[model samples]
Target: MTGKRGRPSVSEALARDERVVDVVIALLTGDGIEALTFDRVAAEAHVAKRTLYGVFGDRTGLVRAAIRRQHAYLGDAGDGSSDLRSASRAILLHLLGDEAVGIHRAIIAAAALHPSLAQEFYDEGPGRAQGFLASHLRAEAAVSPELLFAALLGEPHRRRLLGLAGPPTPEEVDAQVDAVLRTFGLLR
Candidate 1:
């Protein structure tokens, strides 16, 4: 018999995991998060359920990993937000838009009854994004950006995503950025 094959490279492993997350996100966007069962994801990604389990541990694990992966796409840690006033509107609307919003709602809903998953979402999302905005303000604009960042963070936007309200228009989003910029003394 042939000797055991060598372990896969890190990039190979991550490529596999990334594809799974991509399929999950696409499915979530198309079918809704509640419909993204392992079976469905397996069929979509052309992988076995056993493979999903092996890579992500379980359903929650899969979701958390998928969310965390997508979360990086929107991560603000290194990217500049100096143009945040203009970009914020696009970013916020997009964040609260169709592709990103469902997973946010699903994770938040999941987190409500599940502490571990909640913590995971917090770490990957609000915890990181809000903090990055705060740091950006401190470094590029002003001091004590905490309040403004918090105000800019969540709520009605998320509400809009879950059929609780409507999406913010460009005018609304711009008004919010103006308000936040004023708070940071970046604008009048």
Candidate 2:
């Protein structure tokens, strides 16, 4: 059952890892990756230390799980299942959103020390997103999907990742996606 007076019962706590990962996400975005210790996550999630370790193994595992969670959330956007315009807009908005930018900044700060984590982040995050965009594209376009992905992010993403700007509004996302699609000859 409960390991401590304030903590949730183990069965109840472990039932939804989302709660724990959500806490980790908040810590990651709000205080940067340095704040992702098991102590902090367990306390914030009201779970026991044993629960965190039993579920996520160690700090690296914990961080990896959080990154995976982020990837899962962002992966929904540009799945190629939707129409091109909608998919592209969704991808741009999600990529340039506050949480993605925060996670990106945190990962960038930690990447030098955790190269493998960074590589995994890139592979699963932007790499996967680009792959999705590629699937949505026609074969006739001269621009590679990678180039289109870059243009979608472009200056807005850079500004967001650097904390120089906030998340773009839907109108801004629309303008950027329309311009990029037009430039790439994907739009008429």
Candidate 3:
């Protein structure tokens, strides 16, 4: 006799989707974009190929979803508190983190071939983070959130992207955040 069949519960579907995204991110980090095939993701995520196809439609969809998940993860790294300095430091640290750096490099290298991925990365990743910071900025602050984010990242982030240096220590992050706030006169 055949057993009853139905779609997975919402929580189950979410968990499976999360697993797929996690596997894609791991593949992207470990072997770059070249290694992120649906077969590999299915195997690593322990989900079926059909499930991936059904959920994401195609490789591009899967990649976009993974990038979006990465952005959400990075953006959520900070505590939920409204402290500007804390939020700024969290964004800086995430930008400089090894995984984020790798993802950034992969997107840049692949952008010529895949403009959609590049746009998604910018919109969902850095753009989202900047919006988060801008929300916390004082109403009367002279500097725009984009400018403030640039100053907060500045040379250190560039060095990380160029592979010339590692992420800053917590102390260095604090110093930079303080300096950025001071420079913008956004200090409390």
> What ranking of all candidate models by lDDT puts the best one first?
3, 2, 1
Candidate 1 to native Cα RMSD, angstroms: 4.8
lDDT of 3 by residue, 1-188 (tens): 65435788899899989888888778777787778898999998988899999999887777778666545534444345657887888787777788788788887888898887788788877788788887677788899888988899899988998999987899989999999998888785
What's the lDDT for all of these models? 0.66, 0.79, 0.80
Q: Give RMSD (Å) of candidate 2 vs. truth.
A: 3.6
Clashes of 3: 0
Runs in model 1 lying further than 4 Å from the true structure:
1-19, 26-36, 69-76, 79-91, 139-146, 162-164, 169-171
Worst 10 residues of 2 by lDDT: 71-80
Question: Which has the higher TM-score value, candidate number 1 or candidate number 2?
Answer: 2
Ranking by TM-score: 3, 2, 1
Give the C-alpha miss distance for residue 12 in model 1, angstroms: 8.9
lDDT of 2 by residue, 30-90 (tens): 9987898888898988777997898888876767777666555455554546766776897
The residue pairs in collision within model 1 are none
Best by lDDT: 3
Model 2 TM-score? 0.82
Candidate 1 positional error at 147, Å? 3.0
In model 2, how many backbone clashes occur?
A: 0
